[model samples]
Structure formats: structure tokens, C-alpha cells
Target: MLARMTGALRFSPAEIAGFAILAAVVFLVLPLALDTFRLNLAGKYLTYAFVAVGLVLCWGAGGILSLGQGVFFGLGGYCMAMFLKLEASTPAATRIQSTPGIPDFMDWNQLTALPWWWEPFHSLAFSLVAVVAVPVALAWIIGLAMFRRRVGGVYFAIITQSLAAILTILVIGQQGFTGGVNGITDLRTLLGWDIRTDAAKEILYFVNGALLFACLLLARFILKSKLGRVLVAMRDQEDRVRFSGYDVAQFKMFIFCAGAAFAGVGGAMFTLQVGFMSPTLVGIVPSIEMVIFCAVGGRLSILGAVYGTLLVNWAKTTFSESFPELWLLGLGALFIGVVMAFPNGLAGLYADHVEPRIRALLAWLGVRGAMPAPVAGGAAREMAPARSVAGGRQSGRSLQARGGASPEPGP
Candidate 1:
């Protein structure tokens, strides 16, 4: 019944068209007007946009509140940074007797030579894969252990937070591989690509913008699919969804891995654009900010995620530059005000002005039969749910009830 009422404002194509064009305009025009410095700033916001989209899926769609994605983001960033740092070095610089051209901390500690473990990162491709695969595999194992036991909500948040804290401590203590407190620096190039060049900066800017759009498209596709509905089911009624027949743990694992992977992409984009990353980027403060971005954006909504990320980061950058001393106060007041009054987010502002006509267009297109099947969500999940185990806590109808048949099952 609640779903029915909300369906009154069913999604629309006209709205989607308008959004696509506006996004293209922003992507196209911004680089023209902005200086390289400002373009880089836009890149940073785009990275944050990726993070916010993941938060939307894990929080908005799945009902699993994660606070430690920053850790995953950093893992990917630091990993990529290591590779870039390696590539930036000359073969002569890496020689054993080579001037002890150690990382600065090593100079302080009298250490020498890049550690053996750091060597594989010399290959650009390897580093890129490590950045993505490492965090996702870790998230997969962690999600399996936790979600299978049905640990979620606050408990899930706590576990993720603990993971972030542990990672930070480990990185700071290792001193050798991680570069200790000062963190990795002096990274100047990537794969013979001169990062200092305006061309490089522009390319990186395009990478950030393109990835944000891709993630947005992916997020919207997932949300519109039947599997997406199942994920939502698992979010809204974990125990019941299980009893009805779905492998709840597997569904959770997939989204968890996906969210971590998205964070990794964001992290890589961040390191490449910003040219630095440290424990601070992955610490508790950032973990909190990730949640705040999701919350202010609208926990379960993609548009909400994009809006919140761009707006929050813009505010942070804008305020910090203009009034560095008042940055903290400004951020705090702004978040507090938004949470208190417009928790649903600026996406709501967009919807109010434009959604009705969009829905009407979708309905009209439906009548013409020229449109392909509505692909609001993207690629389908491969795993099949054990339907006998799926259902109970929710008042909403399951996909089982909707079609009396499953969409062709995934791998």
C-alpha cells in the first residue's frame, strides 16, 4: 500500500532526459571556464561523487550503514600512490648502492632500499588491478562473515569503523612500506604521463567526470532492476527475506563488494588528481564525513548521493578557501541545518520542479511502444536466490509477488 502511494510519483523519462543533458553541459562547459586549479577541484568533487553513490547503495538501498569506506578508499589510493611513486623513480635511483635515496622517513630512521613487497607495483597495470581487487576481495570476505550472521545496522557500522581504525594504526606503525606518519610524497608522474602538464591535468579531470557519470549510470541501473528490488528487500526485511528463499548473505556480499570497489575507484581518482593521500584521508573524521554525505544526500537515492557529494565538497572547498578559520564552523552549521530541515536532500528540490512531466513522458512512451524495456537499473546480479528461503518482515510486495516469476536468474 505504501509502495502504491509512492508509485503515484513514478519515475519518468522526460526528467531523465533533462538530467542527462544538464550533466553533459556541466561536464562540457565547466572545463572551458575553469582554470587548471579549479578543474582539479572539480575532479576532487567528482571523486567524492563516486563515494556518495556507493554510500547510497549500501545505505540508501541495502540498509547497511557503513562508516569505514574511507579505509577502502585509502587502501586503493595508497596502493595506487605506491605504484605511481615507483614508476616515477629512475632505474638508477632504485640501485642498491644508489645514494640511499630512501623515503624521507627512512633518512630519519637510517633505512635504505624500496621494500621488496613494493616492487611489484613497478608495473602500472598491476598497481591498477591491485587498487581495485584488493579492497573488493577484502570486503567480500568481511561481508560474508558479518552478513551471514545477520549482523547489520549499528553493529555493521561499528565493525567497519573498527576496520578503518585498525588499518590506520597498522599503516602508521609499519613505518617501512607505508612511509609512517608523513605518508608517501614526491610522486610526480604516472606511466610516463607527466602529471604536472596541463594536458595531464585536463585528462585527469575528464577521467573524474567520466567515472562519475559511469557510476551514476551504474547506480541507477542497479536500482531499477529486479535484483535491485531484491537488494532492497534484503535491506528492508533481512530475516523475512531469508525465510522466503533468497540467499540473503550472498546478496549482501555482492553489494558490499560493489560499494568497496566504487570507493576504490574514487580513491584512485583522488590520488591521481590530488597527488597525495595519507592516513588522514581514511581516518575516523573522513569515515564520519562519508556517512554525513550519504545522509544529507538521501540515504537510498542516487540523485541524492550526487547532489550531497557535490554540494558538501563544494561548501568545504569554497568555505575553506575564503575563511579557513571558519571552515569547521561553516560545515557544522550547514550540515546541521540541512539534516534538521531537508533530510531528503537537494534531489528533492529537483524532483519538485521537474518529476511530474518526466513521469508523463515515460507513460506516453509506454503507449507508443517504441521504447525498449525500462532499464532503470543496469546489469543483473548473477546469483540465484533460494526462493524457498526468501520473505517475512516487510509489508511491501516482493519481486516474487510482482511477477509470479523471477527475472531470468544471473550467474
Candidate 2:
């Protein structure tokens, strides 16, 4: 803890304050700088960051490439959307509305009154709880069933994809309760504020930026913890960690649930900004997009996920809507280029290009000396240990026991 804190203390006052100033400008002042349309798109990109952060944990650290983050995102959005819709209908105001207390679709499906299941969501309090609780519960149950059986890799990915597909189907099929394929729409308010107002939208965007920052900090804390090392260990060698007496299933389950919760938060924020939610939001395609976001960002790095989501989503919104024809080809080619060139993700490119320059600059300052050569070599040996092709996960266990080494040199 001291080492980490001390390292943080070394940041130049200028660098630290500049970072704060920049963030304040982007998050606080930028909404005022941009129009509602631009702010809305920026908010969407930030929500993707939330999902990408979760992906970084599951795919990069835990070796679980989940394609069902969209399901969680949709769930959260729908949960909150339901409440907002109900609120707009006015149980939240002077008097409650008539029976059914839901959108018209619920009335059309032969429903007479609000279902007991939806009763809690009428209150904003329950909706907020449901946003986090529901996704985490689903993830916990699914992870328990799959991980304990040692199901993983492509199998796990497929299961998650199926989860997204199935959820979309269910939501669409339930025309009354779920608002059918349209899911939910025409939402005009959130927390008693009219989302239609520019001021409300601006506040929502800032809240989202704050949430993204908080999630990033949370990821940093987790990565610096012993559990994080164990997570990385499990990523490299599941069976070895299991045999070593750790409850591997529990660890995996925890991360899976945490990632799901993050998705939920993102989804909720997304619904508030967009004023809509549909089966399409939670479908297989969107889930895959979430995965692609993290992969394109830099699967192994938290900040990479943020940058990748913003840059790619910005391009998607800017180009796809404008060109209509060549945009998809450009997007497809971008995908191919990223995969073919930077397998580790955009952050990998950043590490490759920028990290070295930063390191060189530090060296030139002579305030921070060069990393000791032997120690530098030992750290690389530590992060990726050698094992014969036949060794399997056993190599990671041996590697962990062998050394306490620093990180590999940037790039």
C-alpha cells in the first residue's frame, strides 16, 4: 500500500493538477460546450466504458470472454426505465394513476393491474436496487452452474451469447410486461427531472462521467490487491489454482457478478440518456459489440478500455450516420486492421508507441534512474514464465512462487 501510495505521491504537482483540470473541463465544462446531441452521444460512449471495464476483468484478468454484458445492461436499463415510465404516469406525484399502473402494452396484453413483481419498481428506490441486484443475481447463478463444472473458454463464451439471445427473445415475447420488441420508450423524466430538458441531460452526462471515473478507480484498487494477482493466476492456470485449495469457482463467480453489476450501471445510464430501451439493446449483437469495445480498447488495461470505447463509438456515430454506404466497410476494415495488427488491442498500440517515449523522458530527467537491468529482466520472466508446451497451467504456479519482480519495461 505504501509503495503504491508513494508512487502516486511522485506525480508532479503540475501533472496532477493538469489531470484534474482536464477532467473538470471535459466533464464539467464540455457539456455546456457541446449541444445536447453531442452530449448524448458522449454519454453513450461513457456507458460503453462501464461495460468495457467489466470486460477487462472477465476477459483480460479472469479469462472469461463474456458476450452477455448487453443482457445485464438491458436489464438495468429496463428496470430503471420501467420506474421512470411509471413515475411519468404519476404515482410519484400527487395521486396514483389507474390500475395496471404500467405502459399501454401491459394493458393490451390482457393485464388488469400491476403484477406483484413490478410493484416494487413503481418506486424509484426499488428500481435502483433492481438495476444492480438483478444482473448480479443472474450472473451469480450462471457462473455457479458453469464454473463449478469447469466449463470455460469458447464454451463459456457461447453460453453468454446464448444468454443474450434468449433474453432478447423473452423480452420481445412478453408484449405486456416487457413492452414487447419495443421494450420501453417515450420516457420523459428521470428522478423527477425532465430528461427532455438540456439541463437534465447535462447533469446526466456529468453523473455518468463521475461514475466512469469511480469504476476506473475501483478497477485500479482491485488490480493492486492480492486477489487481483490470484485472479491473474487463475486466468493463466485454473486447475492449478483449484488444486492449491483456493475456491476457484467462488473467485470466478465474484468477478463475473461484479462485471455484471458494472454492465447494469451502464445500461441504466444509457436508458436515461437515450429515453428508450428495446430488445435490440440487450440482444446478441449488442453484447458482441460490448466485447468488441473492450477488445479494441486494450483488453489488459483499464484506461485502454475507456479510450477504445470513446474513439470507436465516436467514429461509429460520426461516420455510420452520415455516409450510410461506405461507413460499414470502413468500420469492418477497422475491425480487421485492429485484429490483424494489434491483437492485444488499441491500448497495446499505446503501450507500444507512447510508453517508450514516456519512459525515455523519465530517464533523461535523471531524477528517476533507469530500471536495473537484471531486475527488469526478472520481471518479464515473472509476468510470463517459461514452461514446456506440455506443462499447461502448472507453469503459472511455478512462476508465481519463483520471484517478486517489477513489471516488464513499457513496450
Candidate 3:
């Protein structure tokens, strides 16, 4: 019974504690600490967390480096934007424009009729579905073609980057249909409810945080599953995994599509929080920045990715506001610092330096005996004596009492 209970717990004690602390921080600490405006900013940062978490699965586990995730983000944001725009463009609301039933930008560009593509977005249901489906479908096609051909590594990254550049150009060049270089703006409401209110912003923050936690749980399950092991196996030893009766291409494609779906949901959330979507976010720079968020957070750790996104964006906002000219230099230095000092990111630093000290501190505080030792895969390990079990027998009772030097084995 004891062994079964121990084996049933998938996470180590430290990991479970870490997650509990994170939940408290997001759901309790931040709200109590910040004003409404500041909390809204945090909500905006959480939107990026969605993208960073997705990258953890695709790049960290599957070893697929896609430089165009912003494309999917933009797709989802645009989908949501279209719905808001249509809602705001009701004939009664647009009576002053030459085209009384269409978007203001279309009227400005001398477009008398709504574009065929824009027509579908008029339905809230279709728009909601498109927010996720469009990006996944695009990723599916791209993954199918590239993975089937065994195209990966730097070549795959370059192709994705090119796609991002092309999509940005197309959105900019198609003025009447895509709102030109300005992208989508002036989004008024969602489903007849004003999203610009302070109360709405506060509520949306919780919603975003809850959704992020849900995604983290889903990603955690995937990472602990057999398929996740297959992904890592393919990452380190693709030929061996392929020859072991596994369909390597299928796993790669599935992960890539899943990542796209995650990014799409994030983009929609960003549109809601920020009240706009733009071509600027769909270009090469934003996509690469998303990668940096994952890298700085420890790409393999989902929670770390969330923190990374928040920290980096918070730094960006702070420095850009106070020292505008120095913001770019500071950001570049951050990227360099993370890569040079802690290649595995903030999570890596915590695991390597901070966690051991924490354990020692807890032990000194007389709480160590109640906690399990750190997991085996971590950098350090501590052994503890076995305790009494059912029927008064010591757990793992062995040669220790029989005068042998060998200690009880650690889990």
C-alpha cells in the first residue's frame, strides 16, 4: 500500500510545492499586491505565457524549432479582432460612414462591399472556432510536408521565419481587406459587452490566469505520458526511435500542431486584453522574442516559461517606460546574460543553486523529515532513513540492521 501510494505521485515533493506556490502567487499574491492597472499589465503578460508554454513542448521536448509561431498568434488575434470589428460595425453604429454596415477601415479604403473572407467572421461562433482551428490547420499542413521530408534543424527554422515575413507582408499589402500596415484597431466590445472597463479588465485577468493554469496542466500530462518520452527519444536519438517501430513523423506533426493551437488561444487572449491586433506582432522580431521567453524560462519547464514571459515583458515595460533609449541595450544584455550564465534559464538556476539551499533551510527549520527527498533526475540528492510502515515493519527494511554497510536505496 505504501509503495503503491508513493508510485502514484507523479511529481516529486519539491515540484508539488513549487506548483502550489505558483498558484498562490497568481491567484492570491499578485491581486493583493497590485493596482487594477498594474494587474491588467500582468494579465497582458500572461497572454505571452501561453506562447512560451507552447514553445516548451514543441522546441524543448519535440526538438522542433519553429521561428514563425507569431504567425499563428497573429491568426488567432485577427480572428477575434474580426468578430469585434463586425460587432462594432453594425449599421446603426456606422450610419455616418459611406458604407453603413462595414468596418471603418474598409470604408476608408473605398471598399463598398465586405470581403468574402471577412463575411465568415461576422458570425461569433465561426470566429471563435477560427481562433484555434485556423492556426492548427496551417501548422498541420506545414508539419506534414516538412516532417515527412525529414526537413528539420536550422533549415526548418529558416523556412518558418520566411513564412512569418511573407505573412506580414501580405497583411500589410492588402489594405482594403487586412486594414493595411495599421492592422486591426479600435475594437469596441465583445458580444455586446464593453471590454474596455476596469471591472472587465480585472475579471479577464483571472480568466487568463485560469486558462494558463489549465494549459500548464494539460502540457504536464503530455510531458509525463509515453508519447512525451517518444518525443524526447526522437530528439536525442531519432534513428533509434524510428527503427523501434515508432512513427516519428506523426509524433512530430502532432506536437507542432498542438503548439500552434496553444499559440492561437494565446493570441485571442492578447487581442481581448490589449484591445487590438497588429502586423507588428506577426513579424520576425516578435516570433524570435517568443523563443527568448522560452529560453530564459527553461524551455523544458512549463511553469518556468510562464515566469520567463512575465519577467521579460515586465522588464521591457519598465525599462522602456523609464529609460527609453536604454531599453534595447538592456534587453540584448538580458538575452546574452541568460545564454552565458544560465543556459538552461531561470528554472535551471533555481534547480542548480537555489533548491539545495532551500532543502537545507527547511531541514534546519525542522520540516525536512516531513518532506520527501528531491527527485533523482535533479542535480543533487539527499538520502533519508526509512520510516516505520504497516504492521510495525520499517519501510524497505534490509541489510542495514544485518550489519551491512550498504544503505537503503533511494527512490
Candidate 4:
């Protein structure tokens, strides 16, 4: 039993407990506290949480800081938006348009027919598949090209940032097909069910939470696996990892693609919850903001990433609402503070200070299972031999001094 316990204890119980608590809060407490409108807003923020979680793995563990996650996010979002836009732009609904069967923005821009790129999105199944698939495929190409060529560090970041800028400019330039700066808006339904209703928002909120937790679990599983350790090893010592006969580039590629997938799914959820996908969200600023979410949460901690995203976004919304002009200044100060003070983020602070204090308090209060049980067999073996030897020595000294034979032990 003790051996089995030791084996099972290889996995960290503290991490599991943290995830369980996070699940409870996300699934129970928040839904109960926030109203429909606020919950829907939470769902929107949760979409960004998805991006943050991915960043935790890619940037924190894999040490790949992608400044173009918004591109993947936008691709996934636009795929979903295209499907929704098509459904919303049916002939009957667009009877007033010169192009009766096209999106409003396209019609307004003098497009007489739906573009070839927009046609595939008419199928809901294809749209759903493309949401994750498109972003992942793009990431695969980029990762393969960059990692194989040994392009990383600040250079890789700059390249990704440039990609984001280019994509944003393209979106804004191609107003007819891409919806320009206004973006794909006025999304109405999903499979004939109205997503604009309060009940739908409530349902979507729960669904978003479920998906977020699922992603969290997937991330945890990966992090606990051998591959996760390899990622960390690679991040810290890329040359050593490569010298150890491991295909380091493949590992980097896989993580990059995984991060892109997460961001893509998040973008789809964002479109569903918020009813819009815009070029504003598909640019360098939003990409950097996503990184900040992970940074603020503690990049190494997955649960911290989620909380960090929610906290930062909440602060952003509140500050923007209250003191619109000071919001940027406040954000700048926050970034500076996080960099200078909490380099490891909230998780590091909790792990270093709060968790140890909690354990001490629990111990003082005589709480059971405050920590995992110690491995018993080795300690017991060492102590038992010492006791036997000490007893023999003491008995020998006493018997010699007394000049009497020792009695046999009782059964």
C-alpha cells in the first residue's frame, strides 16, 4: 500500500487540487453571482482565457512567444463569422439589398456575388472544421519553416508581429471581402436558433466554461506527460536538447500548432458570445494583450493564466468605463509593475508565500492530510535497525555492569 501510494504521488496533488477549485469556481460560483449580461461578458473574457492557456503552454513552457496568435484567432473567428453571416444573409432576409444573397458589407461594397473564399463557409460542418483546422494548418507551415531554419527568440517574435500587422492591413484594405475595419458584424443565428436571446447567452456561457475546462484538462495532461518536460528542457537549453538526439524542431512545431488551435477555438467562441469578429481584435495590439494575460497570471501556471486573463480584462473594462483617458496609462503602469515586481506572476507569489503559510496553519490546527503522507518503508527500515542496535548496546553495557545474564525476550 505504501509503495503504491508513493508511485501515485509522483503526480502533484497540489496542482490537481488547484484545478478542482478552479473548476468549481468557473462552473458554480461565477454563474450564480453574475447576471445574464455579465455572464455573457464573462463568456467573452473566457474566450481570451483560452488564448492565455495556450500561451501558458507555448510561451511559458515551450518558450515560443508568438505575436500573431490573433491571426489564428481571426481565422477561426472569420470562419465561424462567415457561416453565421451566410445564415443571416439569406435571400428573404436581404430582400432590400442589390445583391440579395450576399453579406451586407459585401453588398455595400458593390460585390455582386459571394466570393469563392466565402462559399465553403455556407456549410456549417465545413465552417466548424475550418475554425480549428485553418489556424492549425497555418501554424504548422509557419512553425515548420521557422523552427527548421533555426529562427527563434526575438527574431521569431518580430516575424510573427509583422505577420499580424500584414494581416490587419489586408483585412482593412480588402473591405469588400474581409469586411474592412468594420468587420463581420450583425451575426444573428446558429442553426436557426437565435443566439441573441438571454437564455441562449446563458447556455453559451456554460458551454464556454465547459470548453475552457476541457482545454485546461488537455493542457494539464500534456504538461504532466514526458513531452511537457521535454518542452521545458528545450526552452531552457535548446542546444543541449538538440545535442541529446531529440528532434527539437518537431517539438516546437507541435506546441506552436497546439497553441494556434487553442486560439482558434477561442476566436470561434468569441464570435459566438459577442456576436462579432473584427480586424481590431486580429492585430498586433490584441496579440500582445493576450501575452500580457498569460504573463500576469504566471506563464508557467495554467490556472493562473485563466485568472490572469479575467482579472486583466475586468480591470481594462472597468478602467475604460470609468476613466477612459487614463486607461492606457493605467495599463502601461500595470505592465511595468508586473515586469518589475511579479516576474513569475500570481502563481509564483501564491506558491512561494501563500501556500506555505496555509500549510503551516493547517498543521498548527491539527488538520489531517494537510500534506501527502511520507514514504514509510525506507524511514521505518532505517529507524528499526538503529533502535535494535541501540537496544543491544544498552543491554550489553547494563549486563556487564550488573554481572548478570540477560533474560530471553517474552513472546
- Which pairs clash inside model 2? none
lDDT of 1: 0.72
For residues 1-411, could you state the per-residue lDDT of candidate 2 as single tens digits?
663456432433323333465367557766777798798778888898899999887888788889889999998889988888777655444133344345666766777777788778878888999999999999999999999998898999999999999999999997888899877888887766789777888888888889887887676566546667778898876766867789998999988998999999999999988888889989988888777778787777676677678888888888978997987688678767777877657656654565456566767888464432212211111222232222487666667654423235468
lDDT of 3 by residue, 1-411 (tens): 663455523766666776788799888998899998999899888888888989988987888999999999999999999999989899999999998999989999999999888999989899989999999999999999999999998999999999999999999998888888998899989888999999988888898889888888888778766787788778766766877999889999999998898898899988988888999999999998999898898777788888899899998998899999998788788888987877668777676678667777888998954456536222112111112112246433543343333235466
Residue-pair clashes per candidate: 22, 0, 0, 0
Q: Candidate 1, residues 155-232: lDDT per residue as tens digits? A: 999999999898889888987678777677777888777786788988988877787778877776776666678887
- Whole-structure CA lDDT of model 2: 0.76
Q: Give per-model TM-scores.
A: 0.80, 0.83, 0.88, 0.88
**TM-score, candidate number 2:** 0.83
lDDT per residue as tens, model 4, 308-364:
999999999988999999988887788788878876677666655676677778778
For model 3, give the RMSD to the true fold: 9.3
User: Could you say which candidate leads in lDDT?
Assistant: 4
Runs with alpha carbons beyond 4 Å of true place in candidate 4: 1-12, 373-411
What is the descending lDDT order?
4, 3, 2, 1
> Local error of candidate 3 at 140, Å?
0.8
Q: Tell me how far the alpha carbon of residue 309 in candidate 2 is from the true structure, in angstroms, after superposition.
A: 0.6
What TM-score does candidate 1 get on C-alpha atoms?
Answer: 0.80
